[model samples]
Target: MVLAVKGTEQEELQSRDRAPQSATVSPTTGFFFTSPYRSLSTQGCFAKITQPAADGDNLQGAFQQGVQQAFAQARQAGVTNPVLCGAIPFDTRQPSALFIPQQTQWFERQAFMASVKPTLAALPTIVRQSELPKQTQFMQMVADAVQVTGGEQLEKVVLSRLLDIETSKQIDPHALMMRIIAQNPQGFHFHVPLNEGALVGASPELLLRMCGSQFHSNPLAGSARREADPLQDRQAGERLLVSSKDRHEHQIVTAGMRQVLHGRCRHLHIPAVPELLSTPTLWHLSTPIDGEVADRAENALSLACLLHPTPALCGTPMLAARELIAQLEPFERGLFGGIVGWCDAEGNGEWVVTIRCGTVKANQVRLFAGAGIVPDSSPQAEWHETGTKLSTMLRAFGLQG
Candidate 1:
């Protein structure tokens, strides 16, 4: 049998003689990438998906078609289960970067796959701003409105903005990480750099994860730190789970996900309760929703797109809050708060929301963070909460606190 790749110039002529067929590429031999920026433009020859559906119309059908197309491309290229991937823009104002493999490889004997890592810039890091008397007055104005409306019941509504960082050609994502290390060194650090886009974060929230149909989604809501001891950590988690304010916030996210997955998945189980997860400096109210798909009909991207901008990331009233963000947030989210992961033609993949993340271009970069505001939320506290969340992404870059 003749083997070939589909994306590069040389493969085009080579593939003209081959017959088309559907094939499954193993997890070990597909395309892979780690994007850090959410806005840069990227291209892939085969299996590249286009813009997402504005609404959930024909999305299932479209996703199915995409899967078929990917298979077709794979067959012609003589590779089984070619690694396929692309970006879905959420927070950025610009079009997403989509990447398919530029070349295909035969997997007969190699145990490890190889990919090129792109140069990237690190986002500027900032320490917690000292609270000033006037800042409280400003937050008070926002707080009063929230309380009057019952939105103030939320444990902590975080709020943050994008900051600009200088960039240069001799880019060193690792060196830049060292600078951040001087600040916030403790967190779940992650780095994914690609020609199309990039993402770096220490996220506190888990949008959704599927492990052989036993799905797990630990939605983080409230944030507090364990008191400087192991027992204290457990106590902090327990306190967070029981806090009415925290529960209210957790419910909004869990319920929103439930609504989004309604009729699409089966055996959906949501405990009539929440659990507490304590981090180094804060405690969060978290809940895990488990379920299986009635029909393995949807791919991870399609399902994830349906649940984008969850109440945890957006607001309880999703449509309204999205509009508010459009009006209030100065910049677009781009890939921020969007879903990122890998899947195949079967629609099975893992996607995580791009929270606690930033964007990097040639030399410049922008980091973003936000908080949910409700009636009980304190603006000052919310601001601090956002700082905590941003630390996730910053710490990944070794940003100093």
Candidate 2:
């Protein structure tokens, strides 16, 4: 992901090996963050008066305006070319928690991550782990999603479940993020502060990215668990690549993306077929879509507001799918399925689907994972799929997931 840098770009990214000071301090210092970062990002609070819109029903319009306001405020505070980084909630009406960093320094993700691998002072011991919907209830939830039409012929719904873990000690946000990155070493990694707790995870799905007038997205919908044997894992990936049910699910997402981008893009490129993508725990059906926007007038956050909850994250015919999700899932999604990434004042940035993540607050950690349910979805299979997704965060807590 190449960034569309504006000014002092090369000097800044290159001068750091002669820079004034390290701006690579963990995002733990001031405010929190959301989305995935192809590069490390840190942002302070949005200058007090710049809180986002919390109306819950508006699309990206109002929130985009709020972010523009925040950037203007940042300039007033004398912060040069300030960038906003943080989490946006799954529900649109909720406010986005983004901020302009007091300082910005870009890091080549691989090389910088290589120089840091510190461990947690202590990993929290789990006292109890409870699934919100439980196994049977989650299966039923999937079944319900499969059956519901929301008064329309629903093609798909992204159903999610929560795992609430009570720990023996307080969880350190910084330590947990470090552990997740060290163990997995993939996806868009972030640790952002919320009103109470912090949002952290390594997300593998790219929701959308903007570099100048160019944009790219990698949406993943279908998945299978990885196997211990290399040959078995390879076979599993191959099977997933050709799975009929999985392909239908994956197509819904790519279709939804095309629908949104069609009117806005001057040229779009999407493969006729999807390929396989793998993380540490699962194999996924992934399609890479890229194009040039008709105009460079919109910034990253503003453009992302239009494509936040793609069918992969939510479902096809987003409105109907959202209605079904609200009626089924027991917990508020908060920022879990929302957008996570950073956008400079220029709107050149990257955001990953906020999957493979959880929220940490004191002794309690809530992990979330979801599965895309089409009419042909199986309850039992969807149950196992979500569990495989949870394994990413569970491993960070030093648990074998």
Candidate 3:
């Protein structure tokens, strides 16, 4: 559904900007969450519970307790069907967050209508785009991976690179979000506020979604860049389907996820083969896995916790891949490759893989993308893959390659 932002200039500003208009009120943190699925869009927060040092091993238990506590608080405020929305970092040990929205709004499918066109007009023009890891350095890292393990210790590892774009003016998070929504109508769109900036993106991968005892996950891997020509685009997708390397990479993720869900789900159904899933910029091999939860009490967040940082995002031999990532990558991957979405008192909600996203603060935006590395992976090819992924956000910012 098209969202018509309130026309007043004050309404266009950050939520913090409108707080002063109210009578001396205690400060409260707010969050925004949405998905291509219209039923999932939500904004505003009545009360929020934060666990700054949540235990990684006990994440499920902690999340359950936190949700119950937040629901209790929401009940006292006469709120019903209350939901929690936020993100979990790639590193489970890192501090993560979820917010219980007090007051929220949901939208239906339609064009976003506004008296004034919500254009990218307010965002600063892109002045420069720089890669965090130079091409040569990234190539060497890939070579090191191939040489160190001799192709046996690690089957695949996802190596990521950052693209930092400096702009001419401060970025308006809302405007950026609007533009993203306009461009990628079918994506899981989100705009989450951070202490210093906002995390925004339109992700095509669903990490997990639960409703009652049923659960579903669509994990994507093995990407091929899209082409403008219809014939070439079809050929690209066909190539991805039969590529031995791409198929192997895709298989590892599917098998890992199935293994993780084995004891937790019943009547699990995973396709023997993957199908093609396409975004505007790339085509990916995707598998849809579904099953009924063995324990009805296990909520969406807990299930997401279990499956997050899948081989699709990290790599096989998860611990080894993570260690390699730490030693090789230059910057910290805060919330990227994480999970984002909402869950309610009931164990029903949707969580999506936070890829094709970026962090926007003031006059700068840092975008991230990763390519899975295997025994025969090419560093130059991986670098190009990241470039293709970054284009999803770059195009949204009204910037071109």
After superposition, candidate 2 runs with Cα above 4 Å error:
1-24, 30-38, 46-60, 120-122, 149-152
Give one digit per residue, the lDDT tens place, for model 3 in 1-401. 11111222323222222233323211112355455443334445555545532342233566456667766656555555667677878877676756655445454434333222546664677888788898898888878876654556788788888899999888777678778867776788777666578788889999998888998899999999999999999999999999998999999999998888898877799999999999988999999999998887888887887887899999988889999989988888989888888877776888899898998889989998988888778878887888889888888888664
- The residue-by-residue lDDT of candidate 1 on 99-137, one tens digit each, is 344333322111111221222345444333332223454
> Judged by lDDT relative to the true structure, which candidate is superior, 1 or 3?
3
Candidate 1, poorest ten consecutive residues by summed lDDT: 34-43
* Candidate 2 lDDT over residue span 1-401, tens digit each: 11112232322222112323355556466443323344654433434322443431233455566666766766665566777777778886665666555555565665666678668555978999999899999999988887773336688999999999999999877788778878767767777777688888888888778889988888888999999999999999999998999999999888888888888879999998999989999999989899988766766666677787889888978888888899898888988899777787777887777888888899999999999998888999999899889988998888888
Q: What's the residue-level lDDT of 213 in candidate 3? A: 92
Arrange candidates, best lDDT first: 2, 3, 1
Off by over 4 Å in 1: 1-6, 9-47, 53-64, 91-94, 102-160, 167-170, 174-197, 211-214, 226-235, 278-281, 396-399
Q: Report the alpha-carbon TM-score of model 1 versus the true structure.
A: 0.71
lDDT of each: 0.52, 0.76, 0.75
Mark the regions of model 3 whose C-alpha exceeds 4 Å error after superposition: 1-30, 36-38, 41-43, 52-60, 110-122
Selected candidate, larger lDDT, 2 vs 3 = 2
Instruction: State how far residue 281 of model 2 sits from its true place (Å).
Output: 0.4
The 10 consecutive residues of candidate 2 with the worst lDDT sum are 1-10
TM-score preference between candidates 1 and 3, better one: 3
